[model samples]
Target chain A: MEVLVTRQINKYFYEPEKFQVLKEINLTVNRGEFLSLVGKSGCGKSTLMYVLSTMDTDYEGQLEIAGQKLTGKKQDELSAFRNEHIGFVFQFHYLLPEFTVLQNVMMPALKQSKYAREDIRDKAMHRLKTLGVEEHAHKPSNKLSGGQQQRVAIARALINDPDIIMCDEPTGNLDTYNTHLVFDIFRQLTSESNQTIITVTHDDEFASKTDRIVQMSDGRVVV
Target chain B: MAGNRFQLTFEIAKVHLLSKPKQTIIAMLGVTFGIAMFIALVGLMTGLNDFTEDITMTSAPDIHIYKDITKPRQSILQQIYPNDMVWVYHQKPKNELTKVRNAKKIIELIRKNELVRGVAPALSSQVFCNYGPVQLNGYILGVDIMEEDKLFGIKSKMKEGRIEELLANREGIIMGKGLAQKLDTKKGDRVVITTPEGYTMTLKIVGIFQMGIGVIDNVRCYANIGTVQTILQQDPSYITDINIKLTDRHLAKKIAAELEAKFDTKAEDWETANATFLTGVIIRNIITYAVSVTLLIVAGFGIYNILNMTIYNKMKDIAILKAMGFAGGDVKSIFMIQSLIIGVIGAMAGLLIGYGLSVLISKTPFNGGDIISLDHFPVNFDLKFYMIGVVFGVITTAVAGYMPSRKASKIDPIEILRGQ
Candidate 1:
C-alpha cells in the first residue's frame, strides 16, 4: 500500500549557477507508514515538501500521491485533490486568526467538501472533542495555549479525514512538554486510522517514532 | 462545483467583522458617509432640476415658438428659402383701430388650418403702477381667457382667481403676490390702473398669486385678452406674439422646423430660448460625476487599506491555502471576496445613509432666494444614482483587492513554510 512515490524529482530555485534547492530527488512512502525526513537548516526538504503537496509545480518532477500522477494538473484539480486527500499542518498552525477553533477545523470542509451545514458542524465538534479541546471550539486560535493550539491544529488537519497528513515541524515552536504532547497526538492519529503520516523534522527524537526515516543533506536525499 | 464556495467566501468575509468588527465598522462608516453625501448632493441636484423644469412647464406653455436670435446665421446655402414673416398683432382696448385691424382678413386666413388650436389676440402695457406711493414699474397683459390659458399655461398655475374670473369683467386684473404686496392689494382690492397714455382706470384686483419664482412674482398682471386689445388701441386681429401650443413637447423642434419650412422663416424651442440653460445642465452633470468619483476614491482607499493588511497578516495562510491545492486564482477570489464584502456592506450602508440624508436635506434651510432658495434643496435620488454607485463600488473594490490578491497568489509556498 505505497501511498506516495517520486522518481527523478528535481526542484530548482532561480539560476542553477546561484541557488539550486533540489536536484534528482527520489522517495516513496507506504500506506499506514509513518515517515520522517530529517535535515539541517536550508537543506531544501521544505522545498521538496512543497513540490510533494503540488503547491509548486515549477520543478521538474515525476511525483505521485496515492498512486495518481501529480504534474501539470490544472490548479483547480490539484486544489480539489489536496483538499479531499491530503491534510497539511505547518510549523505555525496558520489557522485563520478571525476564525474559531471549530471554524479552523471546518476550514477544509468549507474549502472542499459540499456537506450540509450540520454535517460540517457535527464533524468539527467531533474532531475538537476527540482532540480534547472541544472547550476551545468557540475560542479564537490565538487565544488557545501552546499545546492546546497544536492539538487544535491536528484536529483541523484530521477534519477532512484526509488519507495523508503531512506536518512540517508540528512542534517546532513549542516547549519540550508541548512537543511531546503534539507528537503523542500524532502517534494516536496514525495508530487509530493506520493513516500515512509524513513529517519533516530537525529533531531526531521526533523522527525516531516514524516507521521509515529519509535523510537529506544539501539538495539531495543522502539516505 | 456547487458554488457554495461563494457562501464559504462570504462567511469568511462576514466573520472579518467578528475578528475586527471595529475596523470593519470604521471601513463601513466610510462607505455610509460617502454614499450619504452622494445621495444628498445628487438628490438636491435632481430636486433643483425638477423645480426648474416644473417652473418652466407650469409657467410657460409646452411649446413656445419665440425667435432664435442666438442661432448661428444661416449658411448662404441654407437661406435659399424665402423668409416667412408672420405678423403678430397686439390688441388695443375700446378702440376702433382694433376693429379696423381685424377688418383686414388676409393674415387671419391661417386660422383655417386645423393645427391652429386657438387664435387669441393679446396686448401688453408697461406702466409705473402707483399703489399709494409704492411706484412699481410692472407689466400688465390682456388676453382671451380660453385661448391664452392654452398658450401661456396661465390658468393652470393660478394660485388665486380663475382665468374665467378675470375674463368676466373688463376691469378685472390678477396680480402676483410680490406685486400685490408692493401695491398693497389683495383679493378684491381696488387699484387704479393707468395706461402709458396716462388714462387712469380704477380696476379691481380680483386675484393675487405666486409662481414660486421671484421675478415672475414681482411684476405680473393679466386680464382678458380683448380688454387689453381695446386698451392698446392696436389691430383687433394683432397679437404681439402668437404663442403656439402643440400636442407633444418632444416634437416641438419638429413643429418649429415645419413652421419654418412652410412660412420660410426661422423658429426655436425653449431649449434654445436662453442658451445658458443647456450649459447649466452640462455643468451640473459634470459636478455630479466629479463628486461621485471623489467619493469612490475615498471608498477605494478604505477597502485597499483593509485588503492590504489582510494579505500581510494571512501570508502564511496564503501559503497554506496554496498548499491545500488552492490555485492562485482561488487565493485571489478569497481576497477579492473580502473587498467585495466591504463593498456590499459599504453600499448597503450608503443606501441607508443616503436615504436618511436625502430626507434630512429636503428639510434643510438656506439663505432665501440668494443661491437657489431658502426652501428645502430639491432632492431626487433617482435610479441613475444607484446605478452609478453599483458600477463604481464593484470596480473600486475589485481594484482595491487586486494588489493583495495578486500578492497572495504569488506567495512561494516553500519560503512561507520555512517561515521566511
Candidate 2:
C-alpha cells in the first residue's frame, strides 16, 4: 500500500523575484520501500523533502501521508501529526547537546507521550542497541563522534515507530565508512520492519544502493 | 495531557536555564536588587512619615475649638452699607473676650456625638513666671489632668513627676522642660505665677514634660483648671478652649467646619493646622513610589536583554525542537517558564533581604538633638509593601519575557534547518 502520495505538487519562491521551484511534481512511495531523491544543486529536491515532511506549508498541492490529508491543517495539528507519523534525520546530528544520548533519542517520544517514561527509555535503549550505539546512550550527545551521533539520531527517529522517516543528507558529513553504515541501517529498517523512507542525497553510490531512485533536473523529476 | 505537555516543556526549560547558570543568576539578581531596594526605601520613608504623624497626633487635638482673637474683615460698617464698599482707615480694634461661650453646654453636646473620642476643656492664660528677680513671660494652660492624659498621652511625655501628682496637689503645675530650666525650678519647687489680669498665685512645680517641639517646650506649662481660673481671677465655668479627639482623624475637617458653623467659634482640624507637614508627607510618598517603580523597570529591562540574548543563542535548539514536533506555544512556554522561575525566586529572596535591611536601618542609632527625641531610625515593616514589590516584580519580568519568547515561537524551523 502507498504510505505517501503527492498530487501535482507545485512550490514557488518569491524573494528576489517570483520563481517556480517545483513543477507539477507527482510522487508515491509504498510501505517497506526505501527511496532516494537525487538532484543537482538548487534543483528543488530539498524543498520537496521539506514539503513532504510537513515542515514547509507554503505550497499549492494535495499531500496525504499515512492515509491522512495534511495540506490545510492548523500548524499545531500538523505538528501533532508529524510527531505521531513522521520522523526526521538531518544532515547535521540535531541532538540537544545538553541531553544524554538516550535522552536525545527519547525526546520526540516523550513529546508524543504515547508510552510511559520508563517504557520510552527502554525503547530508546533498544533502538540504540539496534543502531549499535547503546554504549554511548548515557553520554552527552555532543561528546560522541560524528558517525556515532548520526547513528543516535537514527535511533531517535525510530523511537516513536513513525510510519515514515524523511532524511536530508543523512550521511553527507560522514566519511565513507559511516555512509555505508547508515545505508545498511536504512536497508535493515525497510526489510525487517517494513519501514518506509524517503531521503535526499548527493552521493550517487548512496542513491544507487536504495530500492528506488527519483532523479530530478531543473525542478522536474526525470526518472 | 496538557499537564504532561507542560511538564515536558518545564523540564526542557529547566535544562536550558541550568545550562547557563551564570546568566540565570545574573538575571535573578537584577530582579532581587530592584525589589529589595523598593521594599527598603518605601519602608524607611513611610516609617519616618508615621513617626512625624505620631508626634503631630500626640501633641495636637484632632479638632481645636477656640475663640478667635481676629476681628471680622466684614465689620459692622460693611454690614450696614449692604452693597456699598466701606473703607475705614486706621480704625482702632475693640477688645473681646477670648473665651468660648456656653462652654459646658457645648462640651455636653459634643460628648453626645458618636464620632467624638474624648473632649478636654482648657483655659489658656498669658502668664509671667517669677524666679528670683527675673520674670519670664509664658502661657499657662489649665486642663483637667485625667482627661488631658487620656486624650494626649501626657503621662508618656512627663520627664520628672507623675500626672496624678497635679490632681493630688491642687496648687501644682506641670512645667515644660525648657521653661522649668529657664526658671531654675525643679519638681517640688514653688514658682510664683502672675496672670496678665494681675492676679498672682504661688504654685508648686509638680512635673517637667517635654513635647519635643522647641517653641512649645520653651514657653508652655499646664495646671489644674481651678488653679488657673483662680490665677486669672475668673469663675469656675470659664473655659477658653475645647480640644476634641475623634474616632477617625480623617473626619476632623468636616466636623471642625460643622462645629464652627454651629457654635460661632473658630474650629481648627489637625490637617489644617499642619498643612505644610501633611504636604511633605504626601510628596515623600510620591517620591518613594516613583523611585521604586523605576528601579523595578530597570531590573525588567535587564531580564529583557538577557532573555533576548538567550533566544538569539538558542536559535538552533528552537528550530530542532520545532522539527521534533514541539509547537510554537510549547516553545513560548519554555522561555516564559524560565522567566517566571527567575522572577518568583528572585522576589522571594528580595523580600527576605529587604526585611533584613529594614531591621538593620531601624536599629541604627540616630540623634535628633534637642528638637526631636528619637534614638533610632524608624522603619515600617508593612507586609503590604512586600506584597506589592513581589507582584510588581513578577509582572515586570513577565512583560519582559513575553516579547522575546513570542519572537522565539515565531521562528521558522525550515529556515534554520535549511541553513544546516
**Candidate 2 per-residue lDDT over residues B343-389, each given as its tens digit:** 99888898999899999999999996667668999899989999999
**Model 1 misplaced regions, further than 4 Å:** A15-17, A114-117, A120-130, A185-192, B1-3, B65-121, B131-135, B151-153, B156-162, B186-204, B264-266, B365-375, B381-395
lDDT of 1 by residue, B1-420 (tens): 457776776676667656777777777677666776777778878777777776755565433433333444444433564475433344233222212122124226435655655444455677667667667877887666677666656665677777677767788888877788777777887776667877666678877767767777788788776666666655456445445555555666666667556554344556666458657867887898689779878888887888788678778777777766666777777778877777777877787788888888887775556222246667796878876766677777788778877888877766777754
- Which sections of candidate 2 miss by over 4 Å? B83-93, B126-137, B181-184, B192-201, B213-215
- Using DockQ as the measure, the top candidate is 2
Q: Where is the poorest 10-residue window by lDDT in model 1 chain B?
A: B95-104
List DockQ, one per candidate, in order. Answer: 0.59, 0.75
lDDT of 1 by residue, A169-214 (tens): 8878799998888887877777878888888888899898778888
Worst 10 residues of 2 chain A by lDDT: A153-162
**lDDT of the structure predicted as candidate 1:** 0.73
Candidate 2 DockQ score?
Answer: 0.75
